[model samples]
Target: MSAIRFEIKLHSCNDRFNNPAVRSPLVVEVDLSGPRLANDLFFVLHDDTTGRTRLSSRLTGLGLAAAVLGELMLIGRVTVELTDGWVGLALVDAAPTGDTLTQTALDHIIAEPSHRFRIWLQFLARTAYTDVAARMTADGLLHPPRGRLSRRRAPVLANTAAWPGGRLNLAIQRRQPLNLQDGVLLGLLVATSGGQLVLWDQNPTYLSASTAALPAPLQELIAQTEAAVADSVISRR
Candidate 1:
């Protein structure tokens, strides 16, 4: 599939912190919208204090790729199709999602509908990392490393630590009900098997309950992604 073109623009915002002090704005519009999976994945993968990410590169790659699929499913651009008892992903729409990475992924699937979820998952996992980082960079969320062996820098949440994943995890940990979007987000994270890594310390039973509570559609999607990740892992082994 061809590349999905990303549009970046400058956006101005005045507030920097909770102190109400106005600071010079350095915001850039990444043109991201509506529960961006890449952003959420980046947030989960990056650690704030040590200025590093805990997830292995392979896990991070697959997790981000699965997040893209979850995003597509959430936006109604794709669905799982059962054909002769065999399940596969089917594209619902071929239109661009404005986010280049998403559109490119859709384009790939549209170009080859016969490809199973595992293939797409592996493809995206290997290829989408650069675009994901690029999006975060455009958003001004990633910070340059102060001093490091590797030049890779950690991402900083602009306003608060409560990113979408954080919020969803928080609600689940607190035994609060999840809305549809949150449910889907949580399902995607669970699929990545990076939920524990993302949320830090949490009870296994509560996590299980949270997963169990997701809607059927989301649960199916999660199952598909988890299978895809497993297949990718096995193929590498």
Candidate 2:
């Protein structure tokens, strides 16, 4: 396979007025509207230096799985059942989700509606990494790995990859109202170690406010992801 390159129009970050220190909304012209939450989550969690997910593969996979389900909820394809304090995913619609990977996940949920949201996370995490990578690679968000044996997907365009983090940071810092998708992205960031590395300045107020707008199931999804990541860490210790 051949390497592919893409160009992103980014305003000069060197301009004093546009400095990232000011958290100036990244002045980059990229049509990020079409991509799904999991796709943006992948880029947000991907390491620019290593071209790998910033968290352990297991944790990242679970995060990505949550992201995909969150997307389904945002699009009205899925809903959640609340039992006491337990949350389970419920398939609200069987229509095509428009993305095959997301649709596949939806199918799994539809096939087994009895699974807990946490179990769904583990099941989806089993293939979320590669499934999402192939989805992005097909969409051209990922550059093909340099080596035949490597599955690492560096961004095709750095600015495009950086846009997710910039958007989240600006939203939190500026106290801008977040849409459900950004809310889920923010939740996933908090669920994984990505929060410390990406958004070093954690704002509990912003998190509480943002999460308040999310549905109960989605909120529980983030909590389950956090617990799963913590369990992974404990097992590693």
lDDT of 1 by residue, 1-237 (tens): 222222211121212111222122222122234447667666766665443666667777777787777667656567665444455577666667777778888888888888766677778888666667767767777766456556465656533324765686678667787655566566667666767777654666766666666433345566767877676568778
Deviation of model 1 at 178, angstroms: 1.8
* Candidate 2 pairs with clashing backbones: none
What is the TM-score (0 to 1) of candidate 2? Answer: 0.81
List the lowest-lDDT window of 10 residues for candidate 2: 1-10
lDDT of each: 0.62, 0.75
lDDT of 2 by residue, 16-99 (tens): 223343322212122235567888889889875456778789888988988988777666677666544466776656788667
Local lDDT at 83 for model 2: 43
Off by over 4 Å in 1: 1-35, 49-51, 144-151, 158-162, 231-237
TM-score for each prediction?
Answer: 0.72, 0.81
